[model samples]
Structures are given as C-alpha cells and as structure tokens.
Target chain A: MRPRPPAMRTKRRYILARILPYGVQVDQKQMYFAVIEAATSLFGDAAVGLAQPAVVFCEGGYVVVRCRRGAENDIAVALATVTSVADERIALRTVATSGTIHALRRRMKPSRRHSGDEEVKIGETYFAVYRYPRQKVDLVEKGIKHQKSLFFTEADLEER
Target chain B: MKITDAGIRPYPAGDSTVARMALEAAGLGFDSAVAIGDAVHRPPGIEILRGAVIGAASVKEVLKRVRDPAVRRADIVYVDAGDTSFNRAVVSIKEVNVVRSIHAARRNAFDHVAARTAAEQGVAVDISMAPIIHLRGTKRQRALQRYADVLSLQRRYGFPLTISSGARSILGQRSVREIRGLCALFGMTGTEVTEALASVGWIAEPHRPVEVVK
Candidate 1:
C-alpha cells in the first residue's frame, strides 16, 4: 500500500518565544492564542499573516494585520485575527503607538518597495503575515499543538 | 415552463460538461432543456451514449443516424425545424461544447444543411428552438461569424434562422413563449417558432424541476 506523505497541507502557524505583556503573562498568552485559533479555523490557511505576542493594531475592538494579498474570503475566514491589505493607495492607520503607524507610513511609500512579507509582536500575540503578491504562501504553526517545537517561553520575553 | 437560449450563453466550454451542467440545471430549476449544440462546441453527453444519433462522426454519420429512424423518438418533435420553430420551446438543453477545442468540420451543423433537412421534413417535425445565431465579434460569436460561409447549409437546405440569448444564468434563461414571441418580434413566422421549440424534444410534464440522466 502506498504510504501517505508528510502533512503537506497549504497552511502553518507558530507560537512566539518571548514574553509579551509582563504582569498579565499567562492570561495574556491564553487570550492571544484563543483569538488566533479562532482566526485560523474560520479562515483556513490563507488569511493569517503572522502569530502570537505580535504587534497587531487593536482598533474598533478588532485586531488588524497589514495584508497585501487575497480579499474578502480571506478576511471573513480570519475574522478572529484582524487583518488588512495595505496597497500603495492607503497608509497603515493602526491604533498602536503613533510611532508604529508613522514608521509604516514612511516604509510603505511607493519608492520604498518591500519584500511584501511581515512578522511583528505587540503585547502577547505574535502577528505574522505571508508575503503579498505571492503566487504561493507559507504559514507557521501557532499554539499548544506546536508547543514541543517551540524554543522560546513566556519568561524569555521579560524586559530585563 | 423552463426555457433557455444558447446563442447568448457564456458557457465555460462548449462540450458535454455544458450538456451535463444543463442536465444538472434541470434539477436546480428546470425539468427540460432547449439544448443548443453544434459539432464544434456541442456538449459530449449525447456523444457518450453508445447509439445516440446526435453523436454522428460526420454529416454522413448524422444522415445515417437520422435515416435509421429506429431511435428517433426524441420525447418531443419539431414542427418546421427551420428558424425559431426548429428549436425554440426546449425546456432544457444538453450543452456539447468544449472551450477552445477543435471540432469536426462535417459534424458542425451551423449551416443550411441541417435547415434543409428540417425544410424537407416540412411541417411534420415539431421542435421548439433557440435560434443558432452569428455575431460580428466575441469568442463564440466570432467563431460563428467565421463559420458564416458554411451557414448556407441551413439556408440552402431550407432551414429557417431565429434569434435567442443562449441562457447561462438563471437570469439568462428566457421564457419559451416569450422567446418565441421575440422570434416573432424579429419577423420569424409562427410555424418557425413552434417547430424550433419542438425540435429539441421538449416535454411539458406539469413543470418538474430540471434533472440529469446518464
């Protein structure tokens, strides 16, 4: 009988290796994972760009990621994880630190072309993204299912 | 009650998939189909049948099949078979087109020959029709226009021509009577409208949803 190949499904997720929020450590990690998992199941493998302890823009009670590829189908599926496509036409209007938004604005200018992929961290969630305009995408494993493979823990991210 | 026009339909491939899809459509919203097919883009379902006459390898093959007369009991029959009367009131269709596929030259009946056969049959054949049309531009339309030279087969053979919007969407399918009326709008004779619809073996069984048969 022909054996099945290793799981080569089109999607992947990964957990962060650092402490995101200090005093609210364990609670923060749980909240972040819950949101990401919800985002993944509904959105399938195409919508998520990044993972936990990531700098995601929390706006209107929603998490936002800077996306540059795919559309509504991806958005609705990844609802738990707020994401957006930033084109040359629009700048990132994130509600994080004003500096973050300003930084994105400068780098996203038409002249400053990017590789079109992204990965960031904010409080306790790791925000990750697949590259924009990519014919193929790569997503990492997120949460406990992938805990063994992880090298970093919550304690590692403390601001010593 | 279910009617379709193939001339204006935007089918993916003009092959059996379209015909099967047409059959599937019968279940979705129709019980019959006014299939509009030509050798070039006609669906392959009829061809798949072992002895389906519509699967003739050539014009001669079609003639051979038609002459057999043993299997010609298409549920419905045509009245005039030329113009709108040749294929108008068909309740559903079996599409026979494959996108961008080459077709047998002799098998293509988008000409006067098929029309001549209908003309020869006279008023005896009863078929509702969705007129085979020719347009100035567009893929299928351009293809028709390219074959316009051969269309004389329908004319030379005495088959009449009519107009239809080849149905591809629920919004695309037209009412049989309204389509016939539209043919009349285009100056087709009454006999032409009746014969065209009957040509495709359209049956009125108290309006059942469309279905697909192997």
Candidate 2:
C-alpha cells in the first residue's frame, strides 16, 4: 500500500433547510446556484468566497449545505434570502444546524404530511380543500390557473 | 424569548388579510405582530397590536399628530424618518416608539444628532426590510450601506433598533430568524440581532418591564 494520506483538516459545518412551496421539487444545482447568488448579493463577492458554500445534499425538499465551520450563519442567511429558484417563488427555511450530519438529522423532526379534506374560504367564496405534506393545500376553484394551491403553516391559523 | 414583527401592513391593499398575516406570524414562531392600520378584528393564538404609520412633512405636524388620542393610544407610533427635521423631532420625543424608513430616502436621513437623541429618549429606530428586498443594483447597495451606518451608530450610541418586514404581502414578510440573518449582513452579531428583535416589545409597551435576550 502507498503511504497513508493524512486526513483532511478543513473543519466544516452542515445546515439543514426545508425548501418551501413545499412539494415543488428543484434540482440540486439550481438550489446551489440560488444560494450562491443570494450570498454574493448579500455579502459581496469577497466575503462569500471566503465562506465557500456548497450544497452537499438535496432530497425530499430538504437541503444540506456545507461551509466553513464558522460560516454556518452566513450560509444560513444566504439560503434564507433565496426567494426564487428557476423563476419560481420559493422559500428556504433553516431548520437545524450541526457540525455533523448525524447530529443535524437527530435534531430535525420528521416533516408532517397534511391529509384529508377541509373547506377553506378564499376571498368571499368557499372551496373544498385537500392537504398534503410541507404545508401544501390544494383548493378546487373554477376559472383559475392549472392548479390552485396554498402553502400555509400552522402559524397562519393561530389565535391571539 | 418572544419574537415580534412590529411593522406589518395588512388588508385590501396588502397581499394578506389581517387574520392570515397574524396566523402566518404565529406559525413562524413570532409571539406577536403589530399591524400598521386601523384597529381591526383580532386573530386567535397570537397577539396582534394595532399600530399607525404617521407621515408628516414637518416637525410641528408630527408633534401635533402624536398628541392625538388615537395616535397616542396606538400600540406603536412609527413616524416617517425621511425628512431631516421630522426625524430630529421624532427622536426627541419619548412617546414616538419608532422612526420608520430612515434609509429609504435619497440621502442618509439620520445623522449623529438624531441617533444620539434617539438613544437618550429611548426611541426605537425602525429599519424596514421592504426597501432592501425591493430595490436592486446601486440603489440596493446604497440602502444596505445606510443601514450599516445606522447599525454602527446604534452600537456606539446605545439606541434601540427594531427591524420590521415592512411587508405589503404575506410573501414579503420574513420570519424572525430570517430577519436576524439579514441584520447579520449589516454587521450585527447574533446577540445584537436578538436585542433588536426584543426591542419591539419594549417599544410597544414602554411601561412594562422588558427582558433583554442575551
């Protein structure tokens, strides 16, 4: 065997984020570009370069980003600022962050799936609705677009 | 710590209805949100405080309006800060809870005097996130710089700073963590951002003993 290669010393941190418009799937490359663009816009070229952000994984509308250890917050902010991807409006909510993927996964609760049907009022009219995971709700409406969906979280229905 | 988005505009003109906005705020983990409009029906689960945005061209007009019973009773009184004289006058008064949009003007609207006075009188300076989200290119850069300057002055003078979405629609509104991250871009540390968010409650109820988030 050749001489053992020394272990890489670069310390890194992982960030767990949930892509909103929930169920809208985006390519990992697109998510990566959006994040980089946001970081560049917010912190300028030089600072973002130092952060060295990279999308390590993307699946099921969840993304894991890796960056320099101390740059987690910078990267998280960049991810938050990404309002769109491939011209589609979206939101990336930072859920959990950790030095190890194991820890991050442990901290992240399982995403709940919205099921069954309910009646919702939009404007003055009432429409039958179907629920899905990731805050996506589908409403049956006439004379609209291809689909009528609303992504709302529990906070959207909370009482004062 | 209770997080609050202290400057949300709702209703027919805005994208989200007041009830929806309140629910969205609560869902995003905000304890309360101050809606900037006439007192409307309250939503459940979250505290929705009624607030007003007073835009006056002169100091006298602002002073006169703040004295009005309706304006005084409002949970938060946000005066337009684009005019230099108006900004100066607003910061001098303790009753004026927030001076809104200091960086939206053509020039740097706030100066050393205003910052100092704001600190002395315990007036919270409102830095709305709407312009930053809407403006682009050089305009956006200038706004960011102005905001950084305000943050620096805030650090030096110990003035209260409250960050708001200034959102006209539900999409425009940001969660508390998102706002804190944006503030970090302007050079605020995590601790500083926490304090800024906490200031919203203090400004809304100055008489109550407020706890500062570490």
Candidate 3:
C-alpha cells in the first residue's frame, strides 16, 4: 500500500457488496490475506498507502479502513459475504453445510459476536458465528451488553 | 452514538487478577477489542453449597478498582503481544478489556430507558443478551421457536444489541459478523447493526475506541 498523498484525506463513502461463490476452497492462511485485500479495496488504495494496511474487526471479519464512522455500512456489506452452511445471516453466507465447506467455516473464526446463536454439531469442529448487536444506539455508543452473547450457552451449536 | 450502562465503577484493583490482565493486555498488542460486563461487587454471601460469594456496592466502585486509565485497547489488532515490537499488532480476540458485561441484551419491548442511557453515555447496547422472553402460551420442540418469539419483542422495543457467548470461560470470544446477526435477530437495522458488530469489543479498534468526540 503506497502512502496516500496529502490530497487523499478527503473522506469517501462506499456501498460495498460481495458475490463470492458459496462453495470454494478457502485456505486459512490466505483467508487472512484475502480479508486484508478485501478490506484494502474498501478504502481504495490511498487511505492506507504501502504500509501493508490494517484490519479493524467488523461484522465477523476485519475491516481495513482509516476511519470507523463512514466505513460501517461498507464493512457490513462486505462481511455479509462470508458464507456458511447455517442460515443466510450476516454479510457472510450463513447456511448449514456439510463436508469440506462446513469444515472451513468451522475453522475460519476470530468471530465478532453472534456465536451464541450459532450451534455446532459433531466431533470437535469449531465454527464461530458472532452474535452482533442490533441497534444503532448500541453499536456506536456504549456497545452491546453481555447477556445477549451470540449464544446463550457454550454447547450451543447450529444443528446439521 | 448511543449510550448504555457500562457497568463500570471505581474499585480496588490493587493486585487483582483482572487488573493485571488489563495492564498486560494494553499496547502489549495494538489490535484490540471491547466488551462491557455487568459491573458487580461480589459480597460475602452463603449459598447452600458455595458458602461465600461477594458483591459490590455501586458501579462507581468497580470503576475505581480499575487502576489503568483504559481497560485495554478494544480495537487496533496486534500481530505480536508486545507493542512497539512491530509497526502494529494484527491481533483479534487476544486484545480485550474485561470491563462490565457489555453482552447483556435489553428488552426491546421496554428499551426506551436503555436506549436513552446508551445515547447519553455514548455507547452501544447489547440487546441480544437481554433476558429470555418467556412465551406464556408457547411451547415447541426447540428453543429456536421460543427464541424467535422473544426476537419479535426485541424488534418492537428497539433494544440495543451485541454478540457474545455467555461462555462460562473467560477465553471465549465471538466474531464481528456473528455479533451483527445477534443484533439483527433482535430486529436491529440501519446503523445499529453495524455499530454493534464494530463496537469496541474483544476484537474492536483502539483506545478511546469511540473517540469521535461526540
């Protein structure tokens, strides 16, 4: 990421989206890099110059942006792209899945909140589904409370 | 921005477990997160089995015990545990400030008070963790149906929201997306969903995470 010119300070808004294929080979090592890439694209190429950019967790994924205010929607829309076999929740593909796809989603964690709602099944395969906050007042202000954790129990796992 | 009760207060954090974790966590890595817990003071009490559990007097007391200016960097992910060790730490859950219970969800049906509190304080509310709504006349094979009934109530009340595990263990953490869904499930929309997922949490931004100067 090349350093942004002084002129690039002007704040920009983006309504981002993701149409990544639901079933594909997603490597863990590359997942982080891919997330970083996805995040970098949100702020164009200038906001984070060549410093390798940064990641701010947003909606079950890392949001690489300079500011939090304008980037919320963009981040939300981008992360909605994360696909799983459960339900079509979040920006990610939240649908119940079996086989390898399920395995990957299980491993792709560092969840944000809604894990409580996500139920896991079988073996020791760990899948993270963050229980995100719901109101505008909560997200930008004090933040969501704890009782509303993603899941109500530790054993809660999405049924297969 | 919205504000809510952070359950924070002054406490005697002198040589405390949480206090040490809070200090060692800050800047040790830049990548941060935030989660507010219910500010509580365990008082010496006798349960038939446990015998003694302590309690606190007030929220302020809990905050006082927190010696560090900031609980921990709620945002700014760090790659390494030591700050200044690298240009930046690309961390996630490792960066957390165990403050008050930030995960408690308020009842959407009667959330006016909660919403107002959060707005006044400049914070997000955890509507997802609100007390489970008991459907007086509804019974089903699973909790989802019951949970769904509560969600509708939340939607109507406009409760603040958040994501969490209510995990009995301290090491557990949730993802931002999952957190967002938690809010959405309770009928959060527009800016609320985004705010909840990004709220300064265990995987949030940096110090003064909400330093917009609101």
In order, the Cα lDDT scores of the candidates are: 0.30, 0.75, 0.29
* Residue range A54-124, candidate 1, lDDT tens digits: 32443222233333223322322233122112210101111221213444343332221124245435345
In Å, residue B158's CA in model 2 sits off its true spot by 3.4
Superior candidate under TM-score, 1 versus 2: 2
For model 3, residues A10-79, the per-residue Cα lDDT tens digits are 4433222221221122344444454444444433455334323222222234222222334444444333
How many angstroms is residue B120 displaced in model 2 relative to the true structure, after the best TM-score fit?
4.1
For candidate 2, what is the DockQ-based docking class? incorrect
lDDT tens digits, residue span B1-214, model 1:
2232323222332312234334333423333354332212233222211111144323333334444444343322222112222232211122211111111122242334334444443311211122221111233333333234333343355443323334442223344433443344234555655544443322222235688998
DockQ order of candidates, top first: 2, 3, 1
- Chain B alone, TM-score of each model? 0.32, 0.91, 0.33
lDDT for A71 (candidate 2): 88
Off by over 4 Å in 3: A1-160, B1-32, B35-114, B127-162, B166-177, B201-214
Best by TM-score: 2
How many backbone overlaps does candidate 3 show? 155
lDDT tens per residue, model 2, B97-146:
88887777646578788889998888988877776665556877887888
CAPRI verdict on model 3? incorrect
Report the number of the highest-DockQ candidate: 2
